[model samples]
Target chain A: MLTPPETEPLTPEDRTLMGPGPSEVHPRVLRVMSAPLVGHLDDSFIEIMNEVQDLLRYVFQTENQWAIPVSGTGSAAMEAAFANVVEPGDTVLVPTNGYFGGRMASMAERAGGEVAYVDAPWGEPLKPAVVEDAFHQHDPDIFGFVHAETSTGALQPNVPELTDIAHEHGAYVIADSVTSLGGVEFRVDEWDIDVAYSGAQKCLSCPPGASPLTLNDRTMEKVLNRDTEVRSWYLDLSLLEGYWGDDRSYHHTAPITNIYALREALQLVAEEGLEARWERHEAMATQLKQGLEALGLELNPEDEYWLPSLNAVRIPDGIDESALLSDMQADHNLEVASGLGDLEGEIIRIGCMGYSARTSNIELVLYALEDALRNQGYEP
Target chain B: MLTPPETEPLTPEDRTLMGPGPSEVHPRVLRVMSAPLVGHLDDSFIEIMNEVQDLLRYVFQTENQWAIPVSGTGSAAMEAAFANVVEPGDTVLVPTNGYFGGRMASMAERAGGEVAYVDAPWGEPLKPAVVEDAFHQHDPDIFGFVHAETSTGALQPNVPELTDIAHEHGAYVIADSVTSLGGVEFRVDEWDIDVAYSGAQKCLSCPPGASPLTLNDRTMEKVLNRDTEVRSWYLDLSLLEGYWGDDRSYHHTAPITNIYALREALQLVAEEGLEARWERHEAMATQLKQGLEALGLELNPEDEYWLPSLNAVRIPDGIDESALLSDMQADHNLEVASGLGDLEGEIIRIGCMGYSARTSNIELVLYALEDALRNQGYEP
Candidate 1:
């Protein structure tokens, strides 16, 4: 028998979360996490599941009946979209502009699809003309693009144009709305996206266990008619349909408490209408952007393509990014993230999302950044 | 624009949870779920991750270095175990005794492995002689068996004997300890289990998001040198190693609140001590069994193979199983489960694990069951 190690009590420090994701959760959502669990198949839980699907439809601005929470984090939903839709030998077109598009290529490849790229530089959105060229070049069966790139802090403009190109080429379009849903403006039906997936921890401000995914009828029909079984039995959409569809049968045990937290988070989304929520995020991020500019920093993305939920600020010369982040954490109990993938060490990401998009959090982030800059012997 | 559906406040009825799994979360676990969020890569969150690993090692009674929580529920962890370890064209052996074994076959097949089975009837443990015969007949590369079969309320006795057979045949042993970890007697190292996976909602009494998985070094070596990419990228162990291993790098975003709950639940396990906790489960379940026997009900499994955490009571003739379950819920707000798969409609499953293994909960189950039986006009 192994001797148990003595672990101290869990008392995590309460910090102002303004990171790239996992924005601070609403108090109501947090409280709901403490609620006792009902069995995953309980009638009440099934009702809760229905309401979540309904709310997800509202957020996506669609009437797709396949809106539901996948039982994992954002990447699971992303994989679910690709793994189910992209069949063997299918040509998949993905953008090379941001981190998540590379992820889509990986998932599509793992799903036995041939991957083709639509190239755009880092921190820039894809041009409709470039996408059309790629579709014409590859005649891809599936097209995936990031609506809001968390790594680049760029939001794709002219979504309808991109979707129109895919549709004209007889392709399905998948949108990575991870950092945009419930915060930035996005429309699934109007934009004609076949499938869209988002994380709960980002703009929804729920914990990251269950993630939202929606698929229109055409996409789900392809999934249902796949010649080969989905390589992942746990994420196979055909198997999951029995549980989430009208049958309400058993597939697997869901994260009951996470569902409760997500429901409360979506309820808050409904209470404060979607358009108002988007405006609040933009207004707060604009304040943060102005403050960073006053401190002699430059935002990475262009004005027209800026992502309001995730603000990527270019690090100034002679400033140690690691030291700046540590100083802010030590002095103000504040959190902002270093850039990911291609932008690592070149930028800092500060988020204004859902519950964390208030004036108080934005002010604290600005004050802490200024303090950290002064401590680093840089006059900004 | 889609109109948002009006959702009522979340007010799920509180019930005494005693089912196959998710047997009543500990109060400490539930309280910690409401704590503030931390970045998945935060230093403090990393420390908590270390503590959770240490506690999991203690409970598993293993000093293996590759113990960590998978980011999704139990099935995800189960898939993680198979999808990484079983290479293409490998012949994997699993038991045909319970519901989970069939699931194992599905996962192994999905991992590009051919599956063979050792035969055993439902509600009975796999015999060591039969396992040895199967190994000799099929020459499998991997063998998986359930340590505690949740669906049939049977526990495999003589675990070392089974592992010995597999080892002599040069086969890796995987144990499904979903219904046994932290409450029943399960020692991964002692039983020579190369891999073991479990759910948090089971014996750990945490919520059902993040799950526990451990692999010994020899097993991980096979995984790191896999011939093909693991089918599921989200569950790829080589990728997960960058996050949970010494690197502490980013994988996908973890379910932060679920990790908090798992840590608290494992801390409770550490405080109680594993042996003491196991004895408590056995004692409480004994009381429940005695009460049911007095009421003229019969448990399905023989005493030697009976699982203390889950009791499978044979349904009496002339009694409607569904109505009995409904009455128990509608009258007392108590949650017990009908049997699954092979045992469906023939038995009722009452769980006695973790926080639900108290004398008070056992008494309540007995009282509620008696009332439900009386309401069904089945006097005993």
Candidate 2:
């Protein structure tokens, strides 16, 4: 038998989260997560479920009847979209522009779909012309691209153009909006996106458990008419439909506390309104970006496609990235992330998302970063 | 655009959770859920991860080095086990004993395994002779059985015998210990369970995310040596090894608050020794059973197979199950479950698990159930 250690009370560092995702959670969401849980099949919880779905649709900018939170984190929602829509032998087109697009390819291949590539270098968004060329060449049944690349901090523009290309090719389009769901400008219907998935801990400012997923009628139709069963039973949408749809039955137990937190978080979104919230993120990120540029740091992506939620700044010469991070963390209870995937060691990711997107946080981040840089013998 | 409802503060009905799972969360765990956030890749969180793994191993009663929590609820962990171990064309043997067995078959088939069944009626434990017979007949590659059948409230006895049979057939064994892990007696290593997975909500009395999963070296070998990739990218344990294993790198953003809740819950388990905790469940369940008998209801399973965590009591003749549940919910705010699958309309599942496994809660359940039955015009 294993002996249990004398564990202390759970008192996390209370750090200011400025990472790629999992921005600091809203106080209301945190409080709601502590609320006692009703049974998953209870009438009250069913009501909560309906409200959560409605709130999810509001933020996703879609009238898709299938808008709901997948009961895991962001990657689970990502897998659910691919695993359901892509059947065996389906040719799936995925972007190579960011870290998440590579993840999309991995999920598609695991779902038994043949993955075809739409080429773009890392840290660059897929151009509509390139997407069109790829569609003409591969004729994929499904096309997936990242709307906001968390790894590269580049937001894909010309959404309607990309969607039109897929529609003309008789392919479904899936948008990976993990970094920009609530705090950025996105329209599912106007942009003609058939499916989109997001994480709660991103722009929503909720904890990372239940993730947001929406599927329009066209996309769900393809899922429902799949030639074979979805390979992941835990993520099967048809089974989840019984629970989230009008049936309101038990498919599996949801993360009830996470759902409560999400409902509260989305309610905050409704109160603030999506447009105003997006502006807030942009305004804060602009302040941080100007400070970085003044401190001799260059933003990685072009200004037109700069992601307001996650600011990626290239490391200056003679700056020690690891030491700077350690000093900032040790001196100020703050967190900033290093670059992931192809961009690793080249840039630092500073998130201005959700409740973390505020003038005070931006100023504090700039000060701490400058102080850390000075300590590392770099003039700021 | 979807119009947001006039949402009030999240005020879910304060419920006495006694359903199949998601029992009343410990107050300490609930408090921790409201605590501040930490990045999943933070050094602080990495230390907490080690502690959580240790605590998990303690409750699971295993020396297996691969013990960690799957990032969703119970079913995600279940799928992770099967999706990794059961490769395509493998003949897997599963029991037809309860709802979960059917679920296991579905998951195995989705994992590309051909499923064969070992026969047993609902609410009954599998007999060794029958298991041996099935193994000899089928010559299966993998065998799965529920350690405690939640749907039917039957505790599977002779665990060693079952594992021995699987081993003799050169098959690995996977046990579903969702409802039994913390509250009841489960010896993972001593019983030779090659793999086992459980939910935090049931016996742990934590919220339903970050479920417990452990695999012995033999099981991990099969998984690591598999020819094909696991179907679900979110649940692939080999990739998970980078985060939870030695590297402690980022695999996915974990549900940090849920992990905090689980650590507190597991600490409580350690405070009350496992044997003492198992006896507490047995004692509380026995009291509930007597009260149920006094109310002229019989438990569905026999004493030897009675599950201490979830008790399946026979619905008295002419007792309206729906009315009984509604009245109990409305009047007492107590949550009990209606029977599922094969035992539907015949039994009501009353849970005495985790924090809800106490004399007061058990007595309250008896009183409320009796009052509901009386209101339904049933008498002793």
Candidate 3:
């Protein structure tokens, strides 16, 4: 017999999450997490599933019948998009602008697709001409681009133009909307995106489980007619269709509590109209950006492509990024993140997203940054 | 622009969960799920992650040092075990007796492994001689068996004997302990199993995300040195090691609230000693079994291999299985499942697991079954 390790009651410190993701979850969503469980196959739960799909369609602004929540976090949904759409022996064109694009490339490669890159710098969005050139040069069957890069805080502009290029080349387009879906302006149908996926924790103000994913009939058709079996049985959409589609059959247990949380979170989104939510995020982030600029810190992306959900600011000269972040946590119980991938050590990301995108939170972030900078002997 | 769906607030019916899984969750675990969010990489969250791993290790009864929660549900963890350990062209041996083994074969095939099966009847446990014969014929590189068959309520007895055969043949073994981990007697170390995975919703009685998985150093060595990349990036252990291992870096945003729920659930297991908890399940299930027998019902499995956590009873002649289950729910807010796969309409599965394994829940099940059966014109 093994001796059990003595573990204390779970008392995690309540943090003001202002990092790249997992921003403050809404109280309604939190309360929903505590609700009692029902079997995944319960009639009531199937109703809940229908409502979730409908809510997801509203949020993604698409009439695609396949709007559903994937079982894992945002990354699982991201992998599902690539693993289903990019078949074996196909060429997948992915952006080189940020961390998520790199992730898409890895998933595509593992899904047996040959990956080709459309080059862009870390703090910039892909230009339409460059995308056109990549399409012509690579002649890829599938193309993926990050709609809002969480790492660099750059929003891809002219989405319709990029999708147009893909359509003209007869290539399907997949959008990584993890940071932008609910908080920023995005239109899956209007933008002609074949598929788009988002994390619940970021803009939905829900915890990170049961992420949102939507696909048009055209893309799903391609996925359904794939030559090779999808490499991941769990992420394979063909099998998932039996459950999420009209059949309502068993396909593993749905995260019932997480689905409840997401229902509440999306209900909140519906109550406060989508345009209002997007405006609120932009207004809060504008204030946060101004305050950081007032502290002599430069915002990384230009206004044309700046992402309002996540504000990436260049770390001031002589400011230790790690110490600055830890000081914020130690002093204010707040969280902000350092840059990732190509922009590592060059920037600090402060998120103004979903439930965290409020005047009080933005004010707290500004005040905390000022206090930390003063302690670091930096004068503005 | 699409109009938002006028979804009602989340108010799901609070039914008693006594199905094959998602058996009633402990209130403490439910309360923990409502706790506020912290950044996934926060210092506080890192501590929570470590505590979760330690608690999982205690419940799994293994010193394997690699016990951690997969980010998704039970199936994801099951897929992870096969996707990582069974590389391309590897011959994997799986059982043909139950639904989960068929799922294993599918996942193994997706991972590029050619699958061979050891045959057994759906309601019976595997024979050691058959497993040895199958291994000798197939020269398998991996073998997988279910420790507790939820579909048929049969426990795989003589686990040490099964694992010994795999070891002598130089094959790694994976155990699906989904229905047996915390509420039944499962000794990972004593049985010398290389890998085991379970769902939080089952014997652990947490929600259906963030499942438990443990692998010994030997199997992890093969995972780490795989010539081909893991098929699913989200389930990839090598990438997950960066987050759950000593590195404590980012792989993906974990299902945070689910981890909190699992921590509290496992803490309950530690508080009530494992032996006492297992005994409680057995005692409660014994009462349930006797009551069903009094109603002239026969359990599917023989006494020698009956699984106490999930009691599979054969449906009576002329009984409408669907109506009987619905009546239990409609008349009394209770849940029990119909058999899956081979025994699909022939048996009703009543789960006694974790928080659901109690005198009251068991008594309710017996009473509800008797009432529903009486309503269906069955006598005695």
Candidate 4:
């Protein structure tokens, strides 16, 4: 083995993360960031790990015993949900509105599921009636959708109704709450979301790493009774339960420090109260919308269906999108993402998620964008 | 949704870890543990992440473009390797000499590969000749084996020879170097290992959240040209390369703080040359072996094949293993594991790896074990 070459010391600029995810981590969370590392199964670390599980349950609004953070990021959690529930030959109905929904469809397909996509435009929500029609036509075993479409800035409404339709046709609902969980109101149990998974980086005001996943008893039973073993042995909840469960048997080594950061972030959420957190995000998003509208920018989606955490705004004609992002990074030390797939070069996604949901930060980003557009000779 | 009930804080004894992993994390690594949480794609954090990648390449002994850390622990890396390479119906040959080897077989099988195991007992090394025989018989597409068998305490010799056999059969070699990479001598490129992966907690002395994985051009070509899409969307290297490769695109949110700890750990290893680190671990293991033998304890495997990192010693007759373990914890705050699977209760696994590979720690653990065995009515 060779030695790593010497390099410069890490000097982080305090940038407000307002992209799709990895929202600005709270300063308190950052302050506790250097806590001493403890063994994964050590008593103290496991205590914190347990606290994280508890915090995740509270945030997810679920009493499920299997509520725990998946080791990888949000995608890992999504994979875990699909791997456990959608075995080979299972028919899974997936909504294709945003990138993540398409990801769910692809993952389901890979899990050997016959995927039936309930199509929706990129910037539109999945209509409950359309899902009902799909259910009547396909009668799938699982229904999957993104609660908050990060890519298209569309927040699906009538989730409880959609889940009801899925249940009426004997299907479990898998919700991707990656961008919605802590930033917006999500009634997991009330909505009959059999499986809901979230990423910590989005609304938890933490870095991306852990995915908080919760499952109802029905989902767990399905996982238990799966005919074929789950394709991913690593993400298999059965083996992981031994480690994250009461037994605390060795699985893969848990990322101890990342868990600490999530714990701190979740504690901040608890202190703020989940509902209050949602209100704060909503209020800040309103402020951002007002500011962006004041700058004569058009929002991606109309009211009620739009996601509050991530606001996708159409780029005005003749505006250099890449240059605007570069300017934001260089001048304001801010980051806003460009759209993906079809939306690419058409919209700039400005996220007000987690700690970045502050009114001041939103105003700063809006002002910066306004300046960049004007400087680039684009009408704002 | 209900929150998990608040529980009492977990109290952890400061135990000296002596197991396959995670060996005792360096105290300095723990002290620097809580570096401020930065966004995964933050410039400064990305700089650190790049450094970590560079360090990983160093430890992997390769300039392979794909050398980087996977978000999950060691097993996740193993899954990533197989999920990226072994598509459905592909033939994967795995060694079954120890626990990890068996795990590989199961993971590969789940990945839709027809897994063929080259048989060896738990406490024995995989015979190169036998492996070659299996290669001739199966002519497998993928050859997988553990370089260091943690369960059996057997260090597989003849890495070059095995790689030659696999390559001769037109197979790409995926080496599970989890317990060998940093603690022992492993030349990934030299041994013609197409894909190699390792756990950070074992030899790197970092808390286990990430696993380092590397692949040469040969393996990358397989991943790039796979006929079927990789089953796992999360573990898929194609998308991961965008995030970890030069482009630095968004994949999932990486575990930022864990990467920080790993970078620091890798820096420590770099500061102390790789050869020096290997010698340190070897010397520490020799000391432990000498001390154990002096206490009339017998190592499970023959001297020639014993692993330096994980030492499996048979429990002397009439010794209460549980009581001895309990006494070690209660009296000395030391953690030495009981065996895994078939070896359970029949042996005690003592580790001398990474930051735990110190003469003083070995002596302390030895003294504690001696007291524990004597207290359990063993005539030591």
Candidate 5:
């Protein structure tokens, strides 16, 4: 009858956010999140959005003419990228190594495009030569692959080489960097990636709402010259241009508070240079990998293709996975995730991105995991 | 090398949000919003999410079992409804009156459906007879339209009749009640609305991140039995069910703080009684309408179809719209929007929704508009 019990107002339960995303929100970011809500169209808010666009361009290392945050989650940006670039009957080649790449193929299909796949094992990166073979084999209108595979903890290598091969075949490269953007090296312009998108919750440390998207002039020209109107009126970049661009028209109400939090998170990223941030994540990951090995665990992906942001560790033989995870949660208040898609039950994913990429947090999780496994009657 | 100035540190400016949402976030909701972050799968957060589900079911006036807030904006909820139900080559009948209805048709097309329209002029409500004719002519598999036309301030009439007609034709009804849900009377079950989605900022008095969506058993079965995976893996109900349903699997990170705000806002609705909340909006709208008329302005829609949540006032002849808006901001610190889409420069949209539907606020806007209009040289 009364407003649901105030129970406990957010008590800031301190825990290491070591999962695929929603990597721990920085305290500075959280402080900025507490800032007052402003009108979405206020001059101040628009000014902030403009700054976010500029910073995103810097982190992505792109001078793309079109760079903005789409109003929905990372998936919205993914759909927007495909919806804007791929037309009906157009051919799109997608990597079949991870769940996200499959997502691109499906969204492109909805956009009425035919899709061909360049297959790779779940924990392996697509070889650039294999991509070249696919280019010669299918002659796709668009080529796309995941930069960091969140599902399997695999970082695809040879990004620039793949983009070069695609561009040679007259295909635009679309990169899904949801788990890799700020914490890894992404030179969109240098790598010749025509389109790229990432989620706010990952390396940005913002809550998951808006998605950052960037497209070069060549891709923008293709979208501008589309024979048909963009299928989604809400996500249509042309209409969105007025809202995100200089002439702000009322398209839809932006999520104002989420934008506020994102601006703060991106500010933190800029304060720490992108290279420094990448080093932080890499160092923390190295610490966790060493600690886990010392505790008698093996990472699912081989060292050659491992993702630093998210590491998938195989559950040691003769241990109850759920019991161990429960112990970690009930005893340690830590949140590491089980695997998704085909890798469930066999692997555990620990993230080291954004605010969670601290050496101290990694040490805590490793210590807690060792205790939890021992408590579950596993010999470690 | 510096972060954007806007991100330097957020200093929240206090402004009266009188345009379309996001309305001024209620103070209590703001407090709840700053609640410390919790894991999406945390027991405490899920406890809150369950309460949110129960509250949403109550507010939507449905027992459809599948009711949860989609993690994106209102448009994302709209996209979810279509992406789940409309497979490739399906026929979707939509009304073409206001901008939102037009948006539904385009989104349906993007989901790989063919769209047919029941025509209504901008600023006019859809006639049930025209929709019946459309059903007969196009035999659409899905019927989508706006319940409250946000852009034109037209509240479509005869929801029960429309749903009945849609059902008779074996078409699922998708209702866009973004602007009408809490302020206006909406009975998802009573009106036979198979799928209904709404935004929080309108009558819920919260920030806009999560969108409430409800699907009836029939609609749920179709989505469950989809032939092809819903195109956008992110929006696919199959994946979403694991997160929002009883079995909580990891989906994309959710906008957790926004959900807290929505839960608190809906709790306010329950405390005041849904019927009482509707009456408050109606009463305030009456006050606003009377005051605007006294100020010599005309409400654009016919009296019967006018939405109480949104008021459209025709710009007085010889008045410069931009200057009038500028004066409203500078002189009174009031925020209102100029016309959108085809109605540009012809009308001003003043929303008295959610927290903004207060008597004192309405009175303040009335006095401010009077002075601002005269200052801009309007003959009033």
Candidate 6:
């Protein structure tokens, strides 16, 4: 028999979360995580599910009845959307501008769809002209793009135009709303995107399980009429509908505690009206951006496509990016992430989201970052 | 814009969870779920991951260093095991004895495997001879069986014999150890289980989200060398290795709270000692069984095959099963489950698992069940 670990009780370092996602969880949401769990199919949990759906609909800004929480993380919700909607032999057009777009391409290919890219450089949003040209060139069946690219800190500016291009080409549009859903302006119905998926941790300030997912009736119809079985049984939405839909039958154990935490988190979002919440994110991010500018730091994305929830601040020359991150973590107990993918070592991502999108957090981040940079012998 | 839900704070019913799964979670685990947030890739979290892996190995009774928790619930881990190991055109042999066996078939088929089954009636273990015959006939690449059938409250006997047969046939063995992992006696290495998957909510008394999965190197080799990609990107073990392995990169956001809860729960398992914990479940179940017998109730599974964690008791003639279930919930604030799948309406599933396996809970269940029976006019 193997010896058991002398593991202590979980007391993780309480860092101020300002990274790409997992922004600070609201106290109410944290409290609910410790709440007693009922059975997954318990009558009470089914009621909780209904309430979460309603709250999710509110957050997603759509009355789509298909709005529900996927049991895993954001990627699971994303894969659920792609695997269900993109049938084998279908042509799927995905963006090549950020980390999530590449992830989308991988998921679509795994679903047996031929992946084609609508290209835009990293740290920039897809232009409608390029998107339309690609749609005409590829004749794709499904088009996926990130509404807010966390990796690049770029929010796609003209969502309706991109959706219009897809609709003109007779394609279903799927939006990766992982970073934009609650903290920024997005309207599922008005935007005319057929499907959208987001994570709880990013803008919701909930923990990272039980991600938000929604599909319009048109997309749900396509999923229902799929010529091929959805590749993943765990992500099969047709069977999932039996649980999250009217039947409320068991699909899998619905991550009960995460759902509870999400309900509380989304309830917070609702209390702060969605638009008000978005403005809160923008205002705090502006404060952070002004502070960074005072330190002579350049923001990576252009203002038109700047994502208020995640700030991509470019590292100045001779500024030790790794040292800046470590000093902040060591001295300030704060979290600001280094760049991802092609932009690695060139930028740091700082987030303003949900409960974390506050003037106090913004001030702390600005103070710590400037202090760390000064320690690295950088002065404007 | 949709109106926000005027939902009150989550005050779910304070319940003593005694269901087929989701046994009463330990207090330590519950407390950890409310712990502060950390980035999924935080250094502290990586250390926690290592401790969880070590604890999982001890609980699973294996030296397999590949043990890790799959994000999502138990079914996700089960799907991960099959989708990775059972490649296209593979002949997968599954059992037809209970609910999960059918689920295994569904997953295997979705993994592009042709499913063949060794038949046994519900609530019965697969005979070694039948399994051998099926392996010979099908020449299957993988053989999966449920070690503890939660639906029927029956634990498979002679596990070594079953695994030995698969080993002789050169087939990898996957065991559904969901119900038996901690509360019942199971040794993954000793029993020669090549791959085993379990849920956190069952015998571990942890909330469901991150689930236990382990693969011996032999199984890992097969998964790594697969001809086709795993169907579910979220459950793909190879890519998952990049995150959970030495690389410490990101694959997906793990359920942070769930991992914390699981770590706390597994630590409790280690402190209690695995064999002693199994004995506690067996003893509590014995007490419950004697009480049911006194109430003129009969258990569905035979004594030798009884699963201590989930006790399936037969419904008496002329008794309303729904009334029996509803009355207990309505009166006692207690939760017990009705039968599922083949055993539906034939039995009531009573759980004596992890934190729920105390003498006090046994007394409460016996008293409540007896009272519910009397209210239904089924007096002894």
Best by DockQ: 3
Candidate 2 lDDT tens digits, B255-307: 98889888889989999888899999999999998899888889999889989
Q: Residue by residue across A1-380, what tens digits does model 1's lDDT show?
A: 79899998889988899999899999999999999888998999999999999999999999999998999999999999999998989999999998899999989998999999999998899999999999989999999999999998999999999999999999999999999999999999998999999999999999999999999999999999999889998899999999999999999999899999989999999999999999999999999999999988889999999999999999999899999999999999999999888899999999999999999999999999999999989898
> Which residue window of length 10 is worst by lDDT in model 6 chain A?
A1-10
Backbone clash pairs for candidate 2 read none
Candidate 2 TM-score over all chains jointly: 0.99
- Model 6 bad stretches (over 4 Å): none
lDDT of 3 by residue, B175-197 (tens): 99999999999989989999999
Model 2 chain B: worst 10 consecutive residues (lDDT sum): B1-10
* Every model's TM-score: 0.99, 0.99, 0.99, 0.95, 0.92, 0.99
Between prediction 1 and prediction 5, the one with superior lDDT is 1
In the order shown, the candidates' DockQ scores are 0.87, 0.81, 0.89, 0.54, 0.39, 0.85
Write down the lDDT of every candidate, Cα atoms only. 0.94, 0.91, 0.93, 0.84, 0.84, 0.92
Model 5 regions lying over 4 Å from their true place? A1-14, A228-231, B1-7, B87-91, B112-114, B129-141, B225-231, B377-380
Residue clash pairs of candidate 1: none
Q: Give the runs in model 1 whose Cα sits over 4 Å from its true position.
A: none
- Per-residue lDDT of candidate 6, residues A1-380 (tens digit): 76787877678998999888788999989999998889988899888999999999999889898999999999999999999999999999998898999999999999999999999999999999999899889999999999999998999999999999899889999999999989999999999989999999988999998999999999999999988788888899999999999999988888999999999989988988898898888999999999999989989999999999999999999998999999999999998899999999999999998888888888998889989999988876
Identify the CAPRI category of the predicted complex in candidate 3.
high
Q: With candidate 1 superimposed using the best TM-score fit, by how many Å does residue B286's alpha carbon deviate from the native?
A: 0.3
Question: Against the correct fold, how does model 4 do in TM-score?
Answer: 0.95
Name the better of 1 and 6 by DockQ: 1
**Per-residue lDDT of model 4, residues A271-328, tens digit only:** 7888998999999999999888888998999898888999999999888899988898
How far does residue B1 in candidate 2 sit from its true spot (Å)?
5.3
- Pick by TM-score: 4 or 6, better one: 6
**Ranking, DockQ, top scorer first:** 3, 1, 6, 2, 4, 5
TM-score of chain A, cand. 4: 0.97
* Candidate 5 per-residue lDDT over residues B1-380, each given as its tens digit: 32233345667666787887767777778777766567788777788888888888888988878989987788888888988899878999888788887778778887779999899988988888998999999999999989888788888888898988999999999999999988888889888899999998888888888899999889999999988767665677888899998888666667887888888888877777888888999999999999999888999999999899999899998888888888888888788888877788899999989888998889888988888888877655
